[model samples]
Target: MAINQKSFDQVTGALSSLDRNPQAVRQRVVALEKVLERAFTVPGTQYKVGLDAIVGLVPVVGDWVTGAMSAYLIWEARNLGMSKWQLARMSGNAVFDTAVGMVPFAGDLFDFVFKSNSRNLRIIKAHLDKHHPSTVIIEGEKL
Candidate 1:
């Protein structure tokens, strides 16, 4: 499938805006949720909850929200037609970032270190490269 850069940018930019929305503002939540799953519970496994559980140790829910947003991006990638392998890789990065990122002060340290969205962006670009060979990949410079 041909991927349009305009559409891709718009979708991601909109998804990134969820953090600022008031609870009552949910027009895009349902639509974006399909592309992004952020639940307190990880389904089918009683033992495994999610970053919220791990990050709850902090004074506020900083790392938890960070991790959920990361998962959301991975979900967005699925909408972008990324392969399962890419999805796994993306999920793993998010998990690692969230898990290590909850350490008292150390976790926040790690969060600053691991940019999951940048990594996921790379994965998406790579997938696009492999699957959409006809499409030209443009850097900051002119193509």
Candidate 2:
């Protein structure tokens, strides 16, 4: 069934409001990081894998797709007023990941270990904790 224009507008409006909320943004970034870096566990092993590793198994296109996803974290950071140095560092992480990830077997292996999205998530969390304390979600507790 097709959604009516009014319903679509309402949904979009609600989403736009959430986009402006730091807490919502934090939650989104955290979820994306998990999906990108820690979504699956290997059988008979403690090791975890995520889309970044699985998708990077493809050739060059995979790296580029994941790299763009990584960029979203940095974009959100900029929206939150992160320092230039911080953004540059995050960008470097993404660029390095994409560049190295262009290699064949080595790049696939690197994708499994070098989680740039996780690193970027850490940076974003630190900034949020310091600047947007209200967005902080303590372990085992809902904010």
Candidate 3:
């Protein structure tokens, strides 16, 4: 079957660029989630880890680099109206991840499991769902 690749691409592009609205924040969150937590598959295992873990292998410098990238999620969450406590929780996660990530080989393993970006994304999504309900829509129903 010959498919119209251009049309498909256009549709996907539109769907993926939902950053115009407040709830569209999920788009960026999802992007960060992919980069920080779910970018690759480990051979012979069902686990996935992303650039955050890969970069954390570079000793001290790597932890800083990945920590900076992870900060973007907290920034976005703040802009999306996450509360102070929520922000603190998110910050705590990032701090812990970065601090532990400073360890030698164990840091890489920590990064694989302690996905701060994903955790922060969940908190942001929940806050948006509860307080700014209009911002989120799910399964064709308004949240």
Q: Please report the candidate that would top TM-score against the real structure.
A: 2
**Which 10-residue window of candidate 1 scores lowest in summed lDDT?**
21-30
Q: Please report, as a residue range, the 10-residue window in candidate 2 with the lowest summed lDDT.
A: 15-24
Give each model a TM-score.
Answer: 0.53, 0.86, 0.78
Candidate 1 overall lDDT versus native:
0.57
- What is candidate 1's lDDT per residue for 22-135, written digit by digit as tens? 221222323333233233345675432333444444634666776777776676667666679989998998788777766777765554445565667667656655665444
Ranking by TM-score: 2, 3, 1
At residue 26, candidate 3 shows an lDDT of: 71
Better of 2 and 3 by TM-score: 2
lDDT, candidate 1, residue 101?
67
Off by over 4 Å in 2: 1-18
Q: Whose lDDT is greatest here?
A: 2
lDDT of 3 at 29: 80
Tens-place lDDT per residue, model 2, 41-66, is 98899888888999998899998899
Model 3: per-residue Cα lDDT over 1-143, one tens digit each:
76699989999899566564565677678778888888999999999989889889999999999899878888877777677999999999999999999999888888888888888878988877787778686785665
Q: Which parts of model 1 are misplaced by more than 4 Å?
A: 1-60, 133-143
Q: What range of 10 consecutive residues in model 3 has the weakest lDDT sum?
A: 15-24
Candidate 2, pairs of clashing residues: none
Candidates 1 and 2 compared by TM-score, better number: 2
